[model samples]
Target chain A: MIAMPDQPSRKPLVELRNLSKHFGEGQARVDALRDVTLTICSREVVGLLGPSGSGKSTLLNAIGCILEPDQGWMRLDGEVVYENRWLRGNLRRLRLEKIGFIFQTHNLLPFLNCTDNVAVVLHLAGWKKSAAIARAHELLADLPVDHRKVAMPGQLSGGEAQRVAIARALANRPRIILADEPTAALDSVRAGIVMDLLHKLAVEQDAAIIAVTHDEKILGRLDRIYRMVDGALSS
Target chain B: MNLAFRDIRHKLGRFVLTSLGLSMLLGVVVTMAGIYRGQTADALALLQATRADVWIVEAGSHGPFAEASRIPGDTREIVARMDGVSEAGSLTLQTVQLVQGDRRLRLQIIGYEPGRPGGPATLIAGREITSNRYEIIVDRQTGLLPGEALKLGRRTFTVVGLTSGIVTLSGDSVVYLTLADAQQVQFDLAPPAARREQARGAARGSTDLVNAVVARVSANIPASLIAAEISRWKHLSALTAAEQETLLTRTVIERASRQIGLFMTVLTLVSAVIIALIVYTLTLDKTRDIATLKMIGAPDRTIIGLIVQQALLMGVSGFIIGTAFVYAFRGVFPRRIEMLPADIAGLFVVVVLVCLAASALGVRVAVKVDPARALAG
Candidate 1:
């Protein structure tokens, strides 16, 4: 257990109520999620720990609006976003404007340079090429290896690639960042650096973060921890 | 960001190799078109070289190529005396096999009067035939050089001149001979066959027959009028030079033209299949990246555009390279290969359409990629 922060309480930035999801059918069916409920406030770093097939990934996908739950209610920034079914709006737009995702492996496109990978999101958000590129350069300049902005993903080191992925996730300045094992592939030193970066991003940008990870060593630095077993969650 | 170009640059070697392979296929397509054009040109080569205003053949014949139209050889003199006739010559066309050393070569033997219509035009080497006996002018395609001796029937003829682009409607190499020699070659039979025919009580056909009479009309008179006058004789048919060309191309070479059309269709389909396979393979190589893009909130159109743009680039590059390859080696082909500018432009349009169609397969694969897969790893 990690001690909770003593900051003033605020409405949850993201909320899930009675979320249920199942896969396959009959004897092959698996209840990936069972009425899971959770909440994380803005400017908070929450860690989720679970073994393989414990539904951590399923819950992340549901929150990211990529997968639908069999029965669910989801609220973001205290506004109802999903009830019985999703609200009548573009889910893709919602994801682009309100959510960010970082994968276990650095999923930067191998073809584009670091800046381009980051700028592509801004481009999708209707920014002009010059403005998006400027914003990409600004975000990259804040990273430790700003000189790698022009280097392709294949040319970047593991740490540099992860940092570039982080820059891409933050480019749109979404309210929520969903990270699935973002530090699972890093060394101890690089993992610590990444945890610190995520912590700083939550506080400075006022964004809520849910990091689904298997690394117990990094849990000490998070504000809260949730454990999932057999499709149920406990904090 | 231009992701297509970026991806290509990232895998420059693979992209270039694929483009090279595609270009060879495209080169074959280009060469096929050139061959069709060459066929048409070869069909018209002899007619254009004759430059005769009118041609007179036996009645009920559709020119000398489509059917045998032998008229009396003395018809040339009678046509020469007609009004508006500047010069008239007897022309005899026959296919003959000539032997040189151990090689046997098939040639379209054209017999014509010296210093008149129906002879090889524009010599590439040596001089035109000055003698009417056993001297011949051969097209360069016959693989004969000046002063080379070739056997025609029982007699040996010396090659006195070489001509370029002289071929029959069927793309056979042409050799020019005197009307008298062609008549003998056409009418004379082997000794045994002649003896057998005599014992059978069949007199040999007249050797004084010519296939057609060509006339160069005066500048002031229309060749059509002269042709109309010749048709009045009721025993012969006359056609203007344009009519003869039409008769040869549309009638004599009609089957070949259809075969080439079918060949072009097959090549185009093959090119489409090749492009489609290459695009599908390339898409398969990038399925992971495509899934990531989907997860990142990139719209399906963006991914589709990436694929379509790459396909277009490959098509254009292949077309350019193929055109260059064909052009550089055009003359080396045994038959003429004609690549016109208009034809190349048309080919570019066709290649772009093929690429568009080919990219549809990749687009189908990309659009089905599940974005959730990005979270798995």
Candidate 2:
């Protein structure tokens, strides 16, 4: 059990202790993740810096509950989710309830308009249709892309779609948000705007956010920054 | 569910086009199935019209439609003498060309006893044959009506009654006549040929050979047993009504039925391929979106469900349109296409299975999508 920090007894929203992941076995084996430990307290914006093949994605996947680490102790919001073995029950529900993600591409379903695309996660989380849409509208209204809420992803500009994606990630009010190269597709100006938006969301929602990027311009906005090299992390 | 439905709505044009194509294919399949069933119904109609429990034909020959069968007309009397036989009558069938104005129409003349086991049960128009000499009852399809004179060999017969749907196994129009008149039409020579034969001093040959003897058995008596007993006489073959229908279905229309079966199989395979291709293409188009969804914590099953739901929706839409098309165009078909509730139900089951199988390809692709692709430069 993690002891709550004395300052208002705030708990770590996400904790990764000695997490390790290896791909394949025998001569072809590749160690994608070495022993790595990290903690993200509530409302903290943590930047994960890495070059190509530095295991940033592997770490993100493990933290996001998409890829199980071969050896690890992972706690989300003070619950031991992975310790030697994955939690067998409701991993999907856990992700739906506690995790959000944003990728480089907007990744909006082309068939759905921006609002519907954002509302889909809330729907999966079992919110009523009216309530989910209401929430989606609220989130989209806050984002810079709300003006295009009725437009499909195909109709939106690159920056507008990315903003919509950020709004979608915030739809379920998750405890933690993981963004992998979320601004990689945008120009520097748009990339700075997206990073600022992520920073604002982390502080306003009081949600821990781990954003993995190699972009130098956005690193200054993060409250804490860690660099990954050869599957290990260094501050 | 909302996402799936929204996806379909957004791609409405492509979805509609695909569904229409699938509907046309399904319609052809349904029509072929209906034709097979219709042929079977027509083949059995002649047997059903006789309303007999047993059929007695020549040994080593199938009766009525499959092959030629000839038994002496006196065989009916012999069959009637059997212990369980109630009544027995001879039926003869002969196909001939008839002239009406400038049109030469093919007609299948069926000879039956007027008030016995081998006549049509009801007449749609006019009256049943009261005189056996020159009166005829014709099916409506033959275009003959009461008071019309029909040329049979050298004699002219007055059409007395008209029946509906009395088509023969070969799909030719049926005309019912008395045994004697049918014998003349079937075996009697032209006046010139008869005169030539008489000049040669040839003995007159009896035209008493009939296609088959239809016998009605007593209630509670097994028709198969009576048929077995008749088969022991060596001169004739006997079949229960059920067996005769099987022979007619299996032998008479065997080639056409097999051809239709083969066509249906090929069509089903083609439909499956088309569905798979369409679904796979759609999945390919949405790959990046799917990767994005996965990166956003959408479960693999969720993505799989979306693909499968789309496929099933497409199939159901296509099937409904196809069924409607088949019903709408039924009348325009030259051959009878009889659609039955059971046939539609069976086809529906097959279509559902095909859709499920076809969707497997898309599901596999969706599940294998790499979420990391969403982050790749």
Report the number of clashing residue pairs per model.
0, 0
Give model 1's TM-score versus the native structure: 0.91
- Models 1 onward score TM values of 0.91, 0.82
Error of 1 at B313 (Å): 2.2
Q: Which candidate is the best by lDDT?
A: 1
Candidate 1, A115: how far from true, in Å?
2.8
Residues A14-77, candidate 2, lDDT per residue (tens digit)? 9989999989899978787888899998867789998888899889988888788999899997
What TM-score did chain B of candidate 2 earn?
Answer: 0.88
- lDDT against true structure, model 2: 0.85
C-alpha lDDT (0 to 100) for residue A209 of candidate 1? 92
Q: What's the distance in Å from true for residue B44, model 2?
A: 1.2
* All-Cα superposition RMSD per candidate: 3.0, 5.0
Best candidate (score: TM-score): 1
lDDT (Cα, tens digit) per residue for candidate 1, span B221-319: 999999999999999999999998888778867787688778878988988898898999999989989988887788888999999999999999988
